[model samples]
Target: MTLLNVENLRVTFRTEAGPVEAVRGVSFNLGRERLGIVGESGSGKTITGRSVLRLIRPPGKILADRMEFDGIDLTRADEKTMRGLRGRRIAMIMQDPKYSLNPVMKVGAQLTEGLRQRDGMSAADARKKAIEALEAVQIRAPERVMEAYPHELSGGMGQRVMIAMMLIPGPDLLIADEPTSALDVTVQAEVLAILDGLVRDRGMGLIFISHDLRLVARFCDRVLVMYKGKIVEELAARDLMAAKHPYTQGLLNCLPRIGGSQGPLPSLDRDAAWAL
Candidate 1:
């Protein structure tokens, strides 16, 4: 049932000075479960997620002792094979819908494009499937929404469209990179609920990358705390509040409480050795 296995995965970007290591010896196993990787901006969380799909751009190199998805070796996969798997089997819902979605394309066209590429279905069939996907994400009047452009939809609606498009191909694994970071609190909850429901109902593995520790604890099954390109702590989501690592504890204490009076949030004291 292990869907994805990454071992000793290292990613480096070629800079003018030299190679800048982004991810360092990161390894994890994902089954049909939700795994949250929580960290700050430069913690290499996003890079690790991108590396799984081999989405690293030029001058960026990904080296892994072993990187396999469902027994298929991703490190050795050709561009064509990776392309077929990228959106079809292992879809990624990026952080911002504004950049992720095509502004010129109608929502309907963009949503069904994945299905068209994967299944080669007729236009009518693709549209039907697109509508179904929109509805699946709890979008009301899916047909109307589909006809509209990305700019016409609200931020939340646009995100829903992105999710629908990603799920239209029925990917076995979903990598959600800061999915609700841009949404309001209420919209964040709604979108998380939709994602949670889909993952559970379809029994698909989810890798949610975020900087919100408390949200990850509440929404994910397992939590992996990353600091400076390494996983410093891994624990059950329920036990995240009781995490042992200093970094993890610092992150937990940083969450703002409604009733509690806080003077100043405790900043994480990073050790130089932790990066190694």
Candidate 2:
């Protein structure tokens, strides 16, 4: 049932100062279930997810003792092989639609481009599929939306479009990095529900990377707490509030509660040894 198995994974960047290791020997396995990776900014959560798809370009290197997807060895996969897997078998939903979507391209074109180019789908078929995808994400009047450019869409609408585009390909494993971060509460909940339904119905595996502990706890089945490029804690999502690691506990303490306290939030105290 294991869909992804990453062990001793390391991502390093060749900086002028020295080689900066962003991901340090991180290891985890994923099944057809929601696995959330939570950490502060620059904690390597995004790096780990991107490494799986071999998305890291030069000046950066990904090394691992074992990085396998299903039965395929990911560490040794060439670009040609990776291209075959990228959107067809594995897909990623980036943090922001404004940055992720093509600014100049019409939404319809962007959505159907992959199908037309990669899958050899005809224009009519691809358009039909794209419209269906938009509908799946609960977008109203998908036809009009498709004709509009990315800039014409609102934040929530843009996000829904991104979700639809990513899901159109029917990937087996999805890496969503802060997918709902830019949306309002109502939109965020709807997006989460869409993701949840897809995972449940399609038996898809999900790697949800986010800084929102409360959201992850409610949405994901399991959680991986990262600190300074390493997984400091791994536990069931329901038990996240009761997490034993100082880092995880500190993060929970940082969450703002309504009517709980009138004082300013406490900052997370860092222990130098946690990085070692």
Span of 10 residues, lowest total lDDT, candidate 2: 255-264
| Top candidate, metric lDDT | 2
lDDT of 1 by residue, 1-276 (tens): 899999999999989999888898899999999999999999999999999999999789999999999889999999998988988899999988889899999998887776677689889999999898889888989989989998999989999899988898789999999999988999999999989997889999999999999899999999889988889999999999899998889878877789876788777787787776
**Most accurate candidate by TM-score:** 2
TM-scores for all candidates: the values are 0.96, 0.98
Give each model's whole-structure lDDT.
Answer: 0.91, 0.95
- How much is 45 displaced in model 2, in angstroms? 0.2
Task: Report how far off residue 69 is in candidate 2 (Å).
Answer: 0.4
Local error of candidate 1 at 3, Å?
0.7
Residue 166's lDDT within candidate 2 is 90
Model 2 reaches what TM-score against the true structure?
A: 0.98
